[model samples]
Target chain A: MAVDTKKCVGCADCVVACQTENNVPHGFCRDWIVENVKGTYPSLDMKFQSERCNQCENAPCVRCCPTGASHIVEGGIVLVTHDDCIGCGACVEACPYDARYIHPQGYVDKCTFCIQRVDKGQNPACVDVCPTYCLHFGDLDDPNSDVSKALKNRSWYVLAPEAGTEPQLYYLR
Target chain B: MKEELMVSGKHIAEIYPVLHLWHWEISLYLFLGGLAGGILFFAAYFFIIGKEKEMSTTVKWATFIAPLALMIGLSSLLYDLHHKLYFWRLFTTVRFTSPMSWGAWTLLIIFPLSIIWVASFMKDMFPNWNWKWKYLNQFESFVIKYRLPFAWILMFLSIILAVYTGILLSAFNARPLWNVSILGPLFLVSGFSTGLATSMWLSKNDAERRILSRIDIFFILTELFLIIHLFMGFMAGTAVKLEAFRLFMGGSFTISFWIFVVLLGLIFPVTLEILELNGYHVPKWVPPLLILFGGLMFRFVMVDAGQITRFLY
Candidate 1:
């Protein structure tokens, strides 16, 4: 996933679309928006970011899960098997991004990158609903894919890169 | 120049990671697990060393407490689980890298072994008691005959159980306060100290009490050294770890960690034990009780404060 920060207007259509599409429970979210403001009032700089699970290459959550419920699937997407999760919260604490939450129904929940939709040849609800076409989702493994092309021509960075998670989410500057 | 950042569409319930997921239940479980480990270790250590007659309370009586403490601790862990019914999944497979998996398996082996160890000593504590069934009686006899070997196994398992309590927290590298390697040894020493204190309190023999107190003072000193080393290591590390160090140095957890865990728990108890060892008129119960109190507070403070220290803030 690559998010074009310059084009984001903080409208949060993606947030609503995700909630509706994923059936994410009320008072909980798998994705959200962050607005960062820098500099003084007379010379202000602001950026809005749409954030969710990083689905890191070196996901600590997967490594720390005792029950193997939080495992990596094809395409390197980290997922939780609800029935297998004991919900001990080890993965919750191990996650550097604070992306996971304990589902009210008694399991850890987090963004799956809308793998269900992606598997069906459709964009994630968040990416599809993005008004500015700021959110791009595709295989980084395929150089001609949307995410690869987005990253090819722009300066991009992942959140908490120093944590060495090798996060898959790319924010285009 | 002043700058402000605003985050919208993020609910406080979901985004706030501080003590939200794990709270008092986990802390209590850690405390009880450590205490149980301490009890079993001392019990087996003395039994294997032929101090069973002198340290009867430690070797016999305290051995019974190990299983009970562990069961209660495990119950707390179960209660804290979100998917309570799915906890059986912990045993279906083992992930070596996951400390929690190691703990579940260790408990599976140790909990039963602890019970059998207690039953083996049951006839000694109550000479008239006997198993209701012949096979049960025969099994008890076999356990008694192989008691020495059981003591060694118990000692080994107890050490793993004690160290595991700390490793469980330290394994989470995302939480800066708990990511240090020192927590393993530190928790082990603290568990032993608490175990010795419990035994000392229960022992009627002044000699046993004095011996345990002297040993406990050593454990307490070791625990203190490890704690200081932990903070110093944090201070010399990354910015996030320094912030974690500040959590006890002068941050929100300062008074709790310093006053309860350090002063009342370690320093005061050690002073009392030292005085008692030197033939001073210190009460026997004071140091042990303080040590136990401090041990509990230590876990509470560590678990609560650790959740607050994160890499991203």
Candidate 2:
């Protein structure tokens, strides 16, 4: 996934859309918005970014899960098998992004990039509902894919690059 | 230049991961598990060295407490588990890379062995107690016959169990406070010290208490060394790790970590034990009780402070 920081307005339509589509429990969210402001008041530079699970290539959640409940699925989407999860909260603590939480039903839950929709050949709900058209989702492996093209045209960065998670989510500056 | 940042829509309560996930249950479990491991290790060590008859408290009486501590510790872990009924899943698979898996499997082996270790000494502890069934009698004899091998296995497993408790927390790289390599050894030495303190407290023999107290002082010093190294490593590490070091240095956890865990828990006990060893009269119960208190407080502080010290703000 690629997010264009300049285009985002911190409106949080994507956050609501994701919660509604995923049936995320009340007061919890699979996606959120961050606003960063830099410089003095007269020359302030601000940016709004939508964030969620990075779908890390070297995901710590999968590595630390004792019961193998948290695993990576097709397209590198990290997922948790509800029944297999013992809900010991190891994955929740292991995640550098703090992207996971124990569900009220006793399992770890996180953003799967809306894999159910993606498997059906649709964009994630957050991507589809983004009003500024800033949230871009596509196959980075394909050279002509929208995500690849977006990254190719803009200088981008991932959150906590020092963490070595190899996070797939990109913010286009 | 100063910069301002604001985040919105991130209202997940579990976002405060430590507050929602690991709490007193984990800390208590870690303490009891370490205590059990320490007790079993000393028991097996003395039995293997032919000192079982001389150190009756270390080898026999303390062995009785091992299984109970483990059961309570494991019960706390079970109570903390969100999916209590599905806990058997921990045994269905083994992931060597995962510390929790290692811990689960280790406990599976140690728990039964602890009970059997106690059972093997039943005839010695009670001269006239007999098993109702003939097969039970035969099982006891078999266990006693190969008791040497059991002692060796118990010793090995106890070390692993003691160290595993610390490694479980240190394995989480996301939490900078717990990401140090020294944690495993630190916890091991601390566990052994607490184990010795317990044995010392229960022993009626003056010689046994002096020996155990001396050994405990060494373990406490080793633990202090490891703790110093842990902080030194963190201070020399990346920015996030330095922030983690600061949590115990002068941050919210300073009093708990320094005063409770260091001064009262380790220093005070060490001083008391040393005085006792030097023919100075000190209350028999004070040092050991303080050591145990310090051990418990150490786990509580580490677990609580570790949760607050994350890689990300």
Off by over 4 Å in 2: B17-20
DockQ score of the complex predicted as candidate 1: 0.72
| DockQ (CA atoms), all models | 0.72, 0.72
Question: In candidate 2, what are the lDDT values of residues A19-79, reduced to their tens digit?
Answer: 8999999877888888788789799998898989999999988888999988988788899
Error of 1 at B214 (Å): 1.3
Give the alpha-carbon lDDT of every model: 0.90, 0.89
True contacts kept of each: 0.76, 0.74
Candidate 1 per-residue C-alpha lDDT over B253-303 given as tens digits, one digit per residue, 9 for 90 to 100: 999999999999999989888877787898778998999999999999999
What is the alpha-carbon lDDT of model 2 when measured against the actual structure? 0.89
Can you tell me which runs of candidate 1 are displaced by over 4 Å?
B2-8, B12-14, B17-19
Q: Identify the CAPRI category of the predicted complex in candidate 1.
A: medium
